[model samples]
Target: MRNLHKIKLLYEKYLNRTATHEEVEELFMLLRDRNQFQHIHNIMEDEWERNDIDFSVENLSWEKVRSEWPTEQKISDVREMPIEKHAIWSLKIRKIVAVAAGVLIAGMMLWWWTKTNTKEYRTGFGETMEIVLSDGSRVLLNANSKMTWNTNWQNIQERTVQLEGEAFFEVSHQRMPVNNSSPDQKDSISLMPFQVITSDLSVNVLGTSFNVASRRQKTDVFLKSGEVLLVAKPPLPRSKNDEKKTAGPSLAKHMDSIYLTPGDHITYSGITRALERHEEKLPDEPTSWVDGFLVYENEKLETVLQELKDIYGKSFIMEDSTMLSRQVDLGLPYEDWYTVSELMSLSLEIEMEENNSEITVKKLEK
Candidate 1:
């Protein structure tokens, strides 16, 4: 049997977050000990169900037991009789079991507390949000997106966040530790490294502004200013049956990293794991949908319609590819749904009708 008083004090320290590093290490070691693990687990399970603890607070006391005694030994001394007494020995065992259970319960509660309190932010459909990070960097989250970081974000060893969907980042300039030399070069002062992970690629930046667009199966990254390193990771491996029957080209294992300068864009084609770089002058319109409209430059009607469908969630079915092909130039205004539809109709000489909330484009057929 273990000492109930000592276990209780150690658990108190853990709840307070005042336990020394050594003390935490010892407590976890005790938890894994086969002889004590089960008893500690039971005690903790019972206490959590009986009393709710406010996890956010820095300090907590077991409300039921707090005022009764200062130390577990004091309580035990009062409740226990001489060890020679049969009843006393039995009582001591019971108390030990109860304390063990408490320890187990507290450990589990602490795990849940840490997970639940972590900072998480998400955007819904047709919605977008902008955030100013602790370091004065900025992030603009697109619709149906999520971003998360630790609560102690400013103090963490590394500044990091998990991004899903799409976002644009403007990182703050801060000196970060760097290696003395690259394997291929001599030592020099290198800037702090920042990273953006997507389904298709991982972007490493040293204080720069960029946009990341990652869908479930595709990813696109565009660098607006500063330099970035783009690395493409291989897709997850498939099972034997899946591998044997696969139809397309074999996935590449080595990642291809390309140094991107301003005005460069890299797109990953999901099927091939091949990266295509566009060096042409980027469009003058705002790449970010939140700030301004996207104007197509002499784009085909079909292409313009496809772009609108992506942003506005409205689909257009062209009856005559010939009419769409004949109209070589078209423009679709964003921010106003009706105006975009009207413009499409006037420019293409076609009528648009909404059926079951979906737009269908049809030519006069004359």
Candidate 2:
């Protein structure tokens, strides 16, 4: 019975996206245990019956499921339909049916102790949002960005977040304010460090505010207060059998790291292993997008388009072969898609066609 406590804690960590790599694998193993599977199955079955839901296929064979699923009624019923690309009719139907069946199987296998302790923050294209974390830290997410972390951050070892796209963070400072801990604790553990991680770069801090932009194999971090350490992703260790197939020698000797203080900016290139910095007396330029206006300083045409994507949560395509190195300096409001497209069309002297959320830019005929 004592081992059950460990299982529950590990399962909680897995749900919060805080579990280590090995812990994730172990959690999967635990979920697949026959007794645990039966428990979840029973719980789900009871709920389905209570709701008068049609779950008659719970005992169907895989072959039968493949042949019978994707009924016309089922296809139209799913709320957020998966994007279907052009493919062979047979393959398309099979994929659609598989997606529907997979949802049912996934629902039966799920387990969670508390939904409130884990939260996900996302912004659709053309939308920006702000939310306060469990530790009183505030995060302002730009358009098309996402941030996910456990709400029980204070009880965990460190405050960490998985990040994508761009966001500005304001971290609250406190010393070892452990959530739900006993008042009569004997040993005093120091406050755990905070980390914001992307695929190419990891920013570690104890307490600080910063803005991060991550895209196109590059990560740009602008520190407004406190300090941060940027570490490059290291190569995964090769397996023993693969090493025997034999390469001559190692290519790089050491990893790269950079330290930043207030009013500093660092951009880590994912392609060339180059760490570039701009030491200017920083303006609010890096984060002014929060105020509904975008500021650029001789940025490339492609980079400006990327910034637009961050705000509108949509994509732009170039119809003609234009110089990507074309630079521009402009400040435009990020209110709506059509307005932003009009500003781009006027500033770049191009014709923009907007259909749905996609914008296509074409060169004007003389």
Candidate 3:
């Protein structure tokens, strides 16, 4: 029998948000153990009764919770557990999930933990890095970006990675024999889909190059060389009222999945709850930053300024507001802020006054 005291402490740590990664994994594993389910269930119930919060699962449907756990063992656990016990389990789930945003979902944590071979890469502001996966795929991670994937893919069916911020992917095509196939069928190979998942959408491709950016509640995908399948959903409602309104309806007729060809660009805005697809004549502009430069083709001066602000934390004020609306085509290196400012001034015929925190732009003196 597992130690009840240790389990309780781990659960308490999880609720307190003080659990280490291994502790969190251990707690979830303990909860999934069929042999200790009764003991753990009783402990949770006792703990809930002791707490004074008005935590309720009365409005939550059991089917919804069951659907979250796809594995047969978890499903069996849900089926056999008494209805009242599900309430406690759901409450625990809600508390665990409420701990943070951008963290892995609790339902999938067990699977992630079991694999225990996941790897993550990250880059800081004004910095870029290159990553090579085990499958010979290459990724150029942009500044302020993060990507994670399971390192051990020998047994996994789909090759998947979770990404935040922006990155350019050069995914290598890989194939495996179909599961449950006979010896004669070993010659048949099927392409394993490579998926890049973000907060707003997922891109599925095989042997393709693409760029993905997810930031500030918006996701953008640009297909460079091959096709990609984009799957998107509306942002999860934050408040109870939002849940009531957005819970029952699908947002768009074409929102579920979209197939993108080369040069196809897609944007999904969480704030507006909309997905838009457009064609870009110059696909290289979207990924020029991968080469340590920002390339803009007929982009607004204001948009260019915002990119500067986002990348270098340098704010800009345009005294000639009309310049903000004027579209400009330009390319600037990422590392040199002074050169960027000079180029912007020369290109727009404006003078930039720079301070520690902000830059003011004015019409050039004759």
Best by TM-score: 3
Which residue pairs show collisions in model 2? 125-312, 125-313, 126-312, 126-313
Q: Which window of ten consecutive residues has the lowest lDDT sum in model 3?
A: 98-107
lDDT of 3 by residue, 1-366 (tens): 446788878867776678899997777666553345456556555655666433333334455544543377865787688999877766666653433211233335445554566898988767789899999899998877889987656666678899998899999989887765688876788888899999887888999999999887889898889888776765432344334222244445634555677887778875686766655557678898988789888888888887677666687887878988988888788776777788878877888888896889898989
Q: Model 3 segments beyond 4 Å from truth?
A: 1-116, 180-187, 235-255
In angstroms, the error of model 3 at 16 is 27
Residues 168-225 of candidate 1 have per-residue lDDT tens digits of 8898875644455576544444555567777676777878888887764667788889
Q: Which ten residues in a row have the lowest lDDT in candidate 1?
A: 51-60
**Candidate 3 lDDT score relative to the true structure:** 0.73
Clashes of 2: 4
Please name the candidate that would achieve the greatest lDDT relative to the true structure: 3
Where does model 1 exceed 4 Å of error? 1-118, 149-151, 176-192, 235-254, 279-282, 285-290, 300-303, 321-333, 364-366
Per-prediction CA RMSD (Å): 12.8, 16.0, 12.4
Regions more than 4 Å wrong, model 2 = 1-117, 177-191, 235-256, 269-272, 279-282, 363-366
- Summed backbone clashes in each candidate are 7, 4, 0
Candidate 3 to truth, TM: 0.63
Question: lDDT score of model 1?
Answer: 0.61
